[model samples]
Target: MPAESAPVGRRERNKQQKLERIVTAAAELFSERGVDEVTTQQIADAADIGTGTLFLYAKTKGELLLLVQNSHYADALERGRAASADARTPLDGVMALATPIIECNRVQVENGRTYLREMVFGDPTEPHHAAALAIVGETEQALAETLSRLASIPAAEASALARVVSSIMFLTMASSDAEVDIAQIVEGVRTQVSAILPR
Candidate 1:
């Protein structure tokens, strides 16, 4: 409870408050209107801040998207990691790896699908790419480690397997919806992994 510490605490609190407002505004507006239609001005207005304030918080709309995506993605991945801590088999580990990510996407499927389509196919300069890499890079290493353990493979092989695993993951979960049946997709991958592997 030192006087000097009070200022630092206040600064942190204020920064968090501003970020919360910005994120809340962005989430609602983006979900309701879609990413293409929502503007920075609208987010700022919704947050009760100046457009200049929003810019101060984020360099571009892409950066804000990245910031928001990072928030939710990291949470989901953290959940995944915790879930995987007990898994022992390769397929069980793969399930550990895939299920939480897809579970995460399940919550934000629509906007997520829009954001992902834009990321892979639309622009070269999306903000989420770097952030996504950093986020996935963390999980990627864990996934690579687990795959290496389960398959008795070398690091390079494990890395390649992780990429293929992630690719299948992205494809399946990117299509996740409130109503789409994904069990078959999961089953198909389970059936095909051995077929795809060298004897």
Candidate 2:
């Protein structure tokens, strides 16, 4: 008979519980006050853990933000993917894929912009940062898949176009104009996307 897998130990469970608390606390605080206004000590206090313990999970506030926002970004991406399935054209599919992400980024505009900055500049050695980067890769992959719906677009070209689309989306989101609403950002992306797509 095959050996049974061992159950999780108390230590592991405790660690997981702590991580969950930290993520929840950070998410709430970040959403309420924005990442710039919330401090690490406040997060630790909200999570009911010490600052030292919190540091173990995320060395900096940015990593904590990543831990919280990564899940949100992943969910938005999934929604976009589902929405893209019903699109009738490549432009429609690409916009359907990007719209949710734009909304997600605008949830708290500064926080969204900070998350993008961290994704670009944060230490890749950190697990949370790596996960954020992986999500970006997945977004590009999804875009490429959507673009490939055009029979004329080969896989390589589709991938390249997807990168361009991804860049457009990110740039729009990370723009300095905080007054730009989700619709405007989406429209900006759409126009750029329309320009690049084959006629």
Candidate 3:
């Protein structure tokens, strides 16, 4: 008979539990007071793990933010995908896909902008940063799929346009002043996207 896979050992289970605690602590702290206001030691203390153990999970505050934000982004994208399905026009579809993501980013504005900065400049070799990039890729793919609803646009062009749309959304989110509300950001994205798409 073939050998069966071994069950998770004690050490591995402990490590997983530690990681979950770290993420929970970080997420709550970051959401309560922007990422700029929180420290690694605070997260470590909150997680009930030593600072050394925290470093093993995420080397920097930025990486910790990535760990916390990546899941939120993934969830927002799923919502966008679902919302897009009911849209009647390409522009509407694009907005449907963009709206939830915009809402997610605005949840903790500073954290959202910082997360974008980290995604662009962080060490891609790091797993959390890589996961952030993968989410971006998925967002673009989803946009491309929405854009493809226009019969005149082929897959290649749709993808290129999607990249432009992605840039518009990211820039609008990242560069907007903290006082700028979500509606303004969404409108800015909508205007730019409408300009690029065929009538």
- Identify the leading candidate in terms of lDDT: 3
- The segments of candidate 3 whose C-alpha lies over 4 angstroms from its true place after superposition are 1-5
Model 2, range 1-199, lDDT digits (tens) per residue?
9999999999999999999999999999999999999999999999999999999999999999999999999999999999999998999999999999999998999899999999999999999999999999999999999888843588999999999999999988898478988888898999999999988
TM-score of 3: 0.96
Q: Give the clash total for candidate 1.
A: 0
Clashing pairs in 1: none
TM-score per prediction, in order, is 0.75, 0.97, 0.96
Model 1 Cα lDDT, one tens digit per residue, 1-199: 7655445578788888998999999988877876668899999999999998888877777666666766777887877777777787777776776566665555555667765554456444545566676666776777788777776879998888777777667776566564765565566555555454434
lDDT of 2 at 138: 99
Give lDDT tens digits, candidate 3, residues 50-92.
9999999999999999999999999999999999999889999
Please give the lDDT score for candidate 2. Answer: 0.94
Model 3: lDDT equals 0.95
Q: Model 3, residue 167: displacement in angstroms?
A: 0.4
Better of 1 and 2 by TM-score: 2
Worst 10 residues of 2 by lDDT: 146-155
